[model samples]
Structures are given as structure tokens and as C-alpha cells.
Target: MGVIGLLMRPSELMALVKLKKQIGVWKRRSAAQEKDADWEFCFDMLNKVSRSFAIVIEQLGDELRNAICVFYLVLRGLDTVEDDMAIDNATKARLLLSFHDMIEEEGWDLHYGYKDEKVLLEEFDRVVRAYRSLKPQYRATIKDITRRMAEGMQKFTEMEVTKIADYDLYCHYVAGLVGIGLSQLFSGSGLEDQGIAQDEALSNHMGLFLQKTNIIRDFLEDHEDYNEETDTRRVFWPKQIWGKYTDKLENFTFGKNQEQAVACLNHMVTDALRHLPYSIEYLSNISDEQNFLFCAIPQVMAAHTLALCYANPDVFKGKIRKNLGECRNTHPVKIRKGLSAKLMLETTDMQATLSILEDAIDSLADKISPTDPSARETIEKVQLCRDLIVQGRRSSSPSSKVASTWRQETSKATSYVAEQCTVPLLVLLFGITAAVDVPQALGSAWWQSEAVPAKLGPVHVWLTSLALAFYSLTLLLLTRGAALSWCKALSAAQVAMTAAEVVFSPVVGLSVVVQALPKLLLAAMLPSCAKQRHSRQLFAKQQAAMGNRRVLRPRPIKADKSY
Candidate 1:
């Protein structure tokens, strides 16, 4: 509990408090009374094996909860056997393939395994007894999935995976199968649509998303066996990806190849994001509120884990995890919004990367100003690293080179005058367009005629002025590389300006479009600029590598905010 308290973020602490209250209410419910001795023992094993999952599982209704509980224990036992490197390859393979068959036999248990999971392994017979007590449909679904999963694990045990496709296949066996099994149970309990269970692709993505994230997060531990002397290392990273970055997977952990390691990590995170849509769809299809929550909690954690692991060098040095407070505080809504924003930015590619770096700097600066001296130093160092990266990117750009050439050709005061005049020149152009439109409308026969439209009276002048003001503000923000909120507001204002034009007169609309096109074009160029900046940064780093120079690694920052 003390270790948990230390690891938990403040938000996770609050979440734990709320969870305890909920569990108390659950204890008073009929669901708690229905638990038998075997079920209680099985649940205790679940807690020991996975405390986080146990919290979500406890919130479920009795029949479904017990079914999932048994399902988890059965898989846990099988995983224990697969993970025990002490077991010979042939023997382990045989046991995995036949593992499902053992569940039907009364009092069947395997105690030889990892010390932490030994309790569940030794007492697995009780889990089998509990499984037998489940309704026929639940038993059938769990048994089928267990058999398929065991078969898949057996296949992988016989050989090492060398390709990305094979890695995905291996993940499918261990995790995707669990997703399918859960969907079956959800359908069997009449809590979700039966169609959901049948959608193998969706179920597979849901499982693969979490599985890939875990694999990436565990790179430091999984790269080598606990005993380096006589044990073969367990290499789960697909050769296809890592091979591109390094000659050997182990090299990624070395300081010299830190950049490559981060690249590999980012590549993996991007791959995991591809499955997000399917995962969201699966969660959305679950109609029950409790069921939806049970499914969502893990997805949110996975999303946050990806975000933390993205640029952080800790993935290579050691295991990285979200604090319990952070994990508990993350909600499905927040994850969904983040995913949406991320996807939008991703579509713009390089521009989005630059935008993200810019945002990171501002965020770090805010934290640096209020922190203790030691913390401030760390924040400042990270900010400096980011600034260097940004500068490197700018130096590599053709536009930057052109600007440098122009500055070299002109005197400092002349260059300054040219820079100062550009904004005023554009504003004057827009102001003239506005001034011309008002007079043209006033002088037109449509304006002087008695039958002038009410919607197109003197109010048109006010709308035109308001639109001009918004357009000018948008242009100013775009020039300054504004925040995302300003960009969103600019987009909304553009819509309003267009709408106001339609309400005013055709001439007014035409004048607005004429003035707005350049601003719109400039707004569109921001992402391209960002993309170019990132490209230049990567190119500069590559050139340094070619010159046999060691590139400086970005220092890790201790920021309070989760990804």
C-alpha cells in the first residue's frame, strides 16, 4: 500500500478512494452475497495476479463477473507455464497445446512455475471447479478460446518470430484470443450484441492494441533473461522493425543508439494507434454502462502508456508506467478526445510534429517558472534540448536559407523595415477592400431603393466590419504560430465570415472571399511549415551521424502532466 501510495499520482489517489467506496456499495449488493467459497478463492487469485483488473472485475454483475474471473485465472495459469523459461521447449510446447484439456479434469493443477503466480498455479484445480459451475454457454466459450490460445502459444514456443506479421500473429494468440473470449461472454450474458463476438477483426485489434503497448513498454526487461550466464534472452521485438534501426535488438539499449531506440519506440506507438479506431468501436458497441467502463479502463491506460513512452528515453533504460493516480484519473472521454486530436494532427504529418514540439516547450516553461530549483533545472535542460531541435530544424529548411540570404544582402535596418512593413501592407490591403465594399453597397440602387431587403440594411456595414476584424486577428495569430485553441477559433470565425457574407450582399460576400483567400492559404501553410521543420531536424541529425559525430541525447524531464 505504501509503494502504491508513492507510485500513484494525486488523481489516482482520489480514484482509489472512490473505488473503495464503490466496492463498499458492491459488498452490500446481492452480487456480493452470491459469491461462494470457490469464487472467493478465485477472486483472491485474480487480485494477486492483477490488482488493477480485479478492481474493474468487481464492479461487474455476479454471473458475468464470476465467468470473467474464471476465464482470467485459466489464462493466467497457461501464461505462467509459457513464461517459465526453465521448462524445456518440447515439454512446454506439449503442455501449452494440451493445457485446455486439463481444465475439464477435476483437481488438475500445476505448481511448478514463477514464484508470484505459484499460488494460482498450485490452486488451479479450484479454478477448474468454479469454471464447471458456470452456465453451459459461458463454459463452452471459455473452453474454446482457451484451446485456441493454447494452440497459438504452442506454435510460437516451437520457434522464434522474425517478421512483423509473425509478431502480430503471436500477439493474436496470447491477447486477441482473450478479447474474443470476452466478447463471447458479453454476448452470452445478453449484455452485448452477438454480432460483436462474431467480428473477429475488431476483437483482434482490441487485444493487439494493448498487447503491442505492453511489449514495447517491457523492452528493457524482455531483451535479456534474468540470469545472463546460461540463459538465452527472450527477444519479442520483431526483427523487421528493430533490424532497420540497429544490427541487434540489444544495441537499442546502448547510449550510442538512443536516437534509433526512440525512433523504434515511436514507430511501435504509431503502429499501436492504428488499432485505436477498432478498439473504440468495440467499446462503443457495449451498451451496458458497467460493461462499457470495464472494457474502457484498460484502453485508456494503454493510450496514456503510449503517450508517455512516445518521446521518453526511459523505455530503453527501464520499465515506464503511469502512476496509479494518473491511471485512475484517466477517463474514456479524455482518451477519446486525445485520440481524436492526435489523429487530426497525424493527418498533417510533419506539421503536427513541429506543433507538438512547440506546445511541449510552452508547457515546460509554465512548469519551470513555478517549480523548485532542482526541478526547474531539469525542466530548463529539457526545454533547451527542445529548442535546439527546433533550431536545427529551422537551419535545415530552404526557406530559412532564403531568409538568411536576404538578410545577408540587406542592411540590418533595411531588413528590419521590410519585416515590419509586411504585416501593415497586408492589413492595408484588407482595410481598402472593406472600405470599397461599404461605399459600393451604399451607392448601389438596391441600397437607395425603397424595397431594400431588411437583412441587407445598415447592419450589413456592421457585419462587414466584424468579419474584417476577425479575419485580421486570424492572420495575426497565424503569423505568430498561434496555439491550437486560436486555430480552432480562427476556423470558426472563417465560417462566420462566410455565413455573414451570404446574409449581406453578393458583393460583400465576394469582397470577403477576396480578402480571406490569402489568410486561408497562410493558415493552411502552418502544418506544411511544421512538417518542413521536422524534416530539416531529422536531416540535420542524419548529416551529423554521417560525419561520425555523436548526436546529443535529449535529457528526460519530470513533468507532472500525463501524456
Candidate 2:
């Protein structure tokens, strides 16, 4: 994480909490449905192979969720074949060419991929079963993309990525195809319109941008994978771009070639930046809010990653940026725990997601918190007590994101309780007082009496009851999150009833004011606008997004059913 990335303030922390809650709600909803072994195994494989993707996939509406999940697994299964260096050239090419057909085949499992990826390969049949269960449109989308991606993978497996066009073409085959497939899946769900998938070039740009970022950051890993001994592994950094700086692509990672490497890195980042406007335009077309988040979360993260990657020499060293491997792989430059949550929470419309992009662009442009050359992040200390403070205590821990989130949520809950109780408490006090005063009007005591209406007149009887009931309803509704309009109208009714109490039957003026003061206070103090305008709009959208978001519980193959 960078300097600014460390401090996750209260709002960002809360966003993370809310995101977890939203995901949990989806999970619980999924759990409540009829799931069989095949469905269970598919989800297990999904969460196993893809980390961030599984979470995002689970949040989609029911119809498309299963299909998207299957789509991802199929691609992961294909990627495994592509990544496994142990597989000889011919057999791997055959597997890559036929991956789409394998998704439909019964009892099809392979054993040649890497560690965790091998799990996906071994039980590939379960994913095939789940894939088969999807709607025909979804199946067609997955198969079509898979077939194309497989052909691309097969072609690239033999050919080295030699030029910029080839790099873009390879990404299109792998990651760009994933983007197109997702857009098609979104359309199939009926959550988004067919128009969303209509612009194929725009969607492809989204994938290219992300895929290029991955290739840039993973330069070390991919370059290391570049072997003269093995013809199978091809380094994705196109020679055409890197060739401008050095004779060899791997030389970019060497300290002696630092300047050339940075120049090359900047070149790659600049290439990726070309697609930002296209990505922004793509997100602008997505109308469904959940689908927007599903797409935008990673898009925003990509921008943040680009901000970190641009002109930074760390990616060439490999440790700061973990490339595609296990599901746990994350770039240190990432938004971290609260980052995804904040983007998901704060990004209401496309405008907000663009604002994040704008911030990243600013960082790249040196507009915000420009990096200082003299500032060293880590210094070798010569002595312990050289600073101004004589006795500095144990280092003050930066506020924990989890702890800060917990405290903020607790404080909100406490404040919510206090807010809910305040008006209602006053209203209840006034209602009780007014109810007590009805018979007190008959007697001497008003503020002094504990009696109900015993000998009051018909007019006073109705007045007291009206006043009491209005107060009760106002308070009751307020605490229950009812519209303030209800309380506003009831306040008007209470005022009229109290005025009649004073007009006909109230013998004491002092008691009437005392008894009616709370409602009058409430009426005067009630907000003209209920909640803050933005908050109301944002939370309303969040409720719609989170509220019973249907995750398709495609039944587990309960019996020993096979294709």
C-alpha cells in the first residue's frame, strides 16, 4: 500500500462493513435455497480459484449469477492449461483448442495444471454440470466466448508475443473475452439492456485496460516464465514496446538497466491509460446499479492500480505486485480492505466512479500529494533517542481498519438509538401528561393529576383523546422510521385538538401549555427535508441493490445424475 492508502478513515471503513453485510445477505439468501452437491461443488470451486471474482459474481441477480460463475470457472480451467509449463506443446494446444467442448462433456477432468488450479481441473465435470444447467442464452454466451478464448490461447501458446498488436490480441483472447462475456451475461439477466452489450469495442477496451495492467505489473513473473528451454511459456511484454528501451525484455528487471526499465514501464502504463476514457464510457452505459458496481469496482481498482504503477519502479522487482497465481494474489498498491467497500459504497452513479478515476489521474499528473524526492519512507537509524521527543512511547498504531469500522458502526447504532428515542420520548411525556390532565380538568389538578377522563364533557373527552392519540401515533411512527410527513400532519391535528381543549373545557391555561409543549416543540423542530438529500438517494439505491438481491440457487445434482 502507498502512503495515502494506509489511512482508512471512518467512511471508508463503514463502506467495507456495509459491503460485507451486503455479500452476507446474498450468501444467506443463497443458503436458504435448494442446493445440491453439484451446485455446492461449483460454488466451492468458484471461491477456490478466483478470490475477488467470486464475491462479485455472488452479488449478481439470480438468473445470471450461476452462468457468470460457470463462465469464470471455465476460463480459470482454460487458464490453468495455459499456465501449466509441465504440459508439453502439442497436448496443451489440443486442450486449449477443445476447452469449450470440455465444459459440456461428461466426466471430463484433467490433472496437469498447477496446485490449486489442479483442483479446478480435477473436478471440471461439476462445473460442466453447473454450466449445463444455465439458460440456453447463457450457455451459448459462455461456449462462444470459451471457444474463441480457447482458439486464441491455442494460437498464442505457439507464438511469442512479438509486438504491441500481438499483446493487445493476446489480452483480447484471454481477458477481453471475459469482459465481453460478462456484458452478455448482464444483458441475459434482464438487469441491464441489450444495448450494454451492443458496443463490443467499448467492452473489449475495458478488458484490455485491465489485462494490460496485469501484464505490466507481472513483468517480473512473466519474464521469469520466459524460458529458452521451454517453448510453451511466452512472456506477454511485447518486444516492440520493450525493444525501444533495451535489447531484451528481461533486462528491464535488472538494476543496471533501471532507467530503461522505468522508461519501458511508463510506456506500458501510458498504453494502458489510453483505454481509460473508453472504460469510463463503457461504465457510463451500464444502467443497473449492481451491475455497475460489479463492473466498476474492478475498473476503479484498475485506475488506482494504474496510479500506483505509473512511473513506479517496484513492479519490476516482483514482490510489491503479485501476479496471477492463487486466489490470494493482491498488489500492494491496491485499495486494500476498505478500498473495495468504499468504491462500492460511495460510487452511487457513473459520475462518482469517474471521480475516483479523476483522482487517480490527478495522482498520475502530480495534482494531488505530489511525491517528494527528499522524503525517504524508510531510514536506517543511527541512534534511538536522537529526535525532539526525549521519551517517545511504543509506536502508536495507526487506527485499525477493522477496529475503526467497528467503532464507527457502534457509534452510528448508538446515535441512531438516541435519535429515535429523543422526539418519541418528548412526545410520550406530553401524551401521558395530556391523558392525565383530561380528568384533572374536571378536578383541581392538571400537571398534578394522574387520572384518566372520568367526568369530562363530550367536547373535552374528544379533545383529550385526539391530543393523546396524535401524540402516541407521532412518536410511534417516528421511532419506526415512518415518513416525517406523517408526524407533520399529526402535529397539525394535535394543535387543533389542543386549541379546542383551551377553547371549551380547559379551566387552566398553564396546564394546557405545559401539556402541549412537547408536540409544539416537535412540530417546530421537525426538519423540512427528512434526511440529507444525498444520503437518502444513496441509501435508497443501496437498499435496492442489497435488498433481497436474488442469487440463483441452481440446485445441486441431488441424485447421482450425469450428463
The candidate that wins on TM-score is 2
Indicate the TM-score of model 2: 0.62
- What lDDT does each candidate get? 0.62, 0.65
lDDT of 2 at 544: 60
For candidate 2, the 10 contiguous residues with the lowest summed lDDT are 376-385
Q: What tens-digit string does per-residue lDDT give for candidate 2 at 407-505?
A: 446755654554555575656666565656555645544444333333566667666666666656655665555544354455455555655666775
Per-candidate TM-score against the hidden true structure:
0.57, 0.62
CA lDDT of 241 in candidate 1?
Answer: 70
Per-residue error for 224 in candidate 2, Å, reads 1.7
Off by over 4 Å in 2: 1-14, 226-233, 254-256, 319-333, 367-563
Best by lDDT: 2
